[model samples]
Target: MPDLPSGAVTFLFTDIEGSTRLVKQLRDRYAEVLAEHQRLLRAAFAAHGGHEVDTQGDSFFVAFASARDALLAAVEGQVALLSHPWPEGVQIKVRMGLHTGQAVATGGRYTGLAVHRAARIGAAGHGGQILVSQAAQTLLEDEEEDLHVFLRDLGEQRLKDLDRPVRL
Candidate 1:
């Protein structure tokens, strides 16, 4: 098993936007493009103390011990993707979300509202956008990092199947 936090953790979720259309548009070389994307993402994640949780196609779920590391990983991942030479001249954009909460990790799986909420926040974002929960924002404020993190308040948003609107 990877050295993931078993209790309190911050989750980062990422998804590729318009992946289906990109695949259709880039056809033969889409696989190579995606491979490069995954590689870049993994490198950024690893560099910033992130633990790989799950990844499918053009999405990734990662866990971090601190909000600082998680947020930095997200920002650096975006920077890397923007600078990569995408194959076949195809452009790609990704959305990311983060939420800090306690979760149960057993047998290599994470189950809890934190994870679900994180995924929903990611889904609600536009390509190249990052959405972070209020909990994560608080964590950010509590920790000082060398790199600055800036966020635009989205206010409380009603998320899919969530009981209360989450502050994003």
Candidate 2:
């Protein structure tokens, strides 16, 4: 296992939307598609210095030490997924969410509201969309224009079980 991120960390969570439908449609071929999807996403995330924290079914939970790296990994992962040619021309859309906050790392797992908030943020997004919390966005404010990405104001979104709405 790789070293996990600690303290102030930016997390990237991703889930394949309508995955059960995909499984029904693809059947046995679904495994191949899933493997390729994971490969692409893992490659993209690793390239941006992301550590694979966990994978639950068709969802991935990754951690990054840098806020910019987390966002960049999300973009790269999305682009890779979009560009991949799936078996039988099937399209796989994954939703991602990013958040930056302090968390406690224990026994190779993270425990804190920040972790829950990050998961909720990812759960609230639609496929192909990368939703970023205001905290993560703020951390990227000092980034260079060379990053070549736009952070559109998406207003505030209320995540599941969260007390307050998070600006995206």
Candidate 3:
């Protein structure tokens, strides 16, 4: 795994979709499913040079040196979850969001509007969806990598606590 960023970095937030329902639906087996979910997601993050910031329940906050790397981790995580075989017929889906901006890294944690914006973007997305902020999208625009083909223009989106709509 790559070193975790200590300064300005891209933030990636992920939450298991329908977690409450899954918890009740899976009951005793939920713990096993959750462990697998964490393993799968952490593997993707490691592969993409992401540093885990915090995780509470099914939500994870990760940091990456590059916005592209953060986005790649999100895609990789989603793809992994989509194909994972759950116990019984249960299913798990995750919603991920990414944003690139300056953050204050203190005590191994990041704080600032960038973190909040990243969380809001994650909340706005549905299961299996990857949402990127305008800043991040612009960073990837000049690149000719195959990743560009997977990005969907969601247009401008009004995020919570933000004063204006941002081009997504």
Candidate 4:
């Protein structure tokens, strides 16, 4: 495990919407949709040069070398999932968040406020929406046309366990 550079790294967090309810309702059917969702996300992330850091049930934590790639991957993932048909009684909506900041890398994993902030931002987004931190927004500010298609600013939010509010 090596320490990360002092500069900035991008983190992306995503979660499946209504996953618990859908699991309860679909029972056996949930497995199929979940598998498909995983496949799509993995492919899109790999294609966009994003590295998968961790996964917990229906949620994913990934890292990218740049904010642009992370945001693009998130947007593409949502679009891909939206275009797919789900199994009967199953819905596959996802909420994603991206943030760029200094982080520590150890044991092949990333840690620090940036990762936590990304998770919080993802939680703040609605299903099918992509939310980004102020740091990420700043990076994409000049690429309005490229960003307008998927990312949206939900404004500043006070995240749990953090002192100050983070813009998303």
Query: Which structure among the candidates has the greatest lDDT?
Result: 2
44 Cα displacement, candidate 1 (Å): 0.5
Per-residue accuracy of model 3 over 65-99 as CA lDDT, tens digit each: 99878888888898899999787778798989888
Candidate 1, residue 118: lDDT = 89
Which candidate tops TM-score?
A: 2
Per-residue CA lDDT of candidate 2, range 1-168, in tens? 777889999999999999999999999888988989999999999899998889988999999998999999999999999988776658899999999999988778888999999999999899999999999999888783768888888999888899999998
Ranking by lDDT: 2, 1, 3, 4
Question: Is candidate 1 or 3 superior in lDDT?
Answer: 1
Candidate 2 CA-lDDT value: 0.91
Residue 18 miss distance in model 3 (angstroms) = 0.5
Rank ordering of all candidates by TM-score, starting from the highest: 2, 1, 3, 4
lDDT on C-alpha atoms for all candidate structures: 0.89, 0.91, 0.86, 0.83
Please identify which of the two predictions, 3 or 4, would achieve the higher lDDT against the true structure: 3
C-alpha lDDT of residue 154 in model 2: 94
The residue pairs that clash in candidate 1, if any, are none
Give lDDT tens digits, candidate 1, residues 1-168: 675687779999999999999989988888988998999999999999898999998999999998888899999999999988776567889999999999998888899988999889888898888899999998787554455766778999999999999999
Report the Cα lDDT for residue 68, model 3: 79
- What ranges in model 3 sit over 4 Å off? 1-3
